[model samples]
Target: MFLTQTVPRQREIIEVLFRNGWGYMRKLLTGGKPEDPQLPTPAVLKKIFIDLGPVYIKLGQLLSTRPDILSSAYIEELSTLQDEVPPVDWSEVEVLIRKQLKRPLEETCKYLNPVPVA
Candidate 1:
């Protein structure tokens, strides 16, 4: 049943893994073009956990402290994870801001960056 439902997303998942320079995993997933200078694996892992949602976020939080299981650099990166809502595109954020404030994003703040700071 799980396989039936998620078969559609399998391609997406594999592409994500491969693009993250996890291409060794391609045998288990669809092909993807690797990004040059490849994204930091820790950041990629963080994004995956965030995409997987809250329960996984909680798991990430716990795993962040397990130095024996992950490398120091990975632990440092994982430690930055927070159990907050995942990030969305700035356009969606602008829409939400306007809906809640009942005003355009330009009117509410002195400055708004088109892209969020990571």
Candidate 2:
């Protein structure tokens, strides 16, 4: 009785492993190789999300917020990725600020605070 249940579980695990291995082999055979020859690791899906630009990043962040919709592991990984993006340069920010304020940096505020207080 117990053997019947265990056998199906074992077979399921084996099938999953086989499919994954075969898929990886297919990628290798098709020249879907990594750029780094010495450290040829599979392309990380998280890195893909990061590379896809702000839209995907925002989707991941929103998915992280929806715990009910996402799996626990997915939520955790996406949460970790929430703000892992590269910051825009200060120069760009300064330019935007000047444009919005319609004034030079010196005229914006008498006592300009570079960093905002919490």
Question: Per-model C-alpha lDDT, please?
Answer: 0.70, 0.59
User: What tens digits encode model 2's per-residue C-alpha lDDT throughout 63-93?
Assistant: 7788898667677777766656655456767
* TM-score (C-alpha) between model 2 and the true structure: 0.41
Highest-lDDT candidate: 1
Q: How many backbone clashes are present in model 1?
A: 0
Q: Residue 77 in candidate 1 has what lDDT?
A: 73
Indicate the residue-level lDDT of 30 in model 2: 67
Worst 10 residues of 2 by lDDT: 36-45
Compute each candidate's TM-score over C-alphas: 0.50, 0.41
Model 2, runs deviating above 4 Å: 1-60, 111-118
* Residue 59 accuracy (lDDT) in model 1: 79
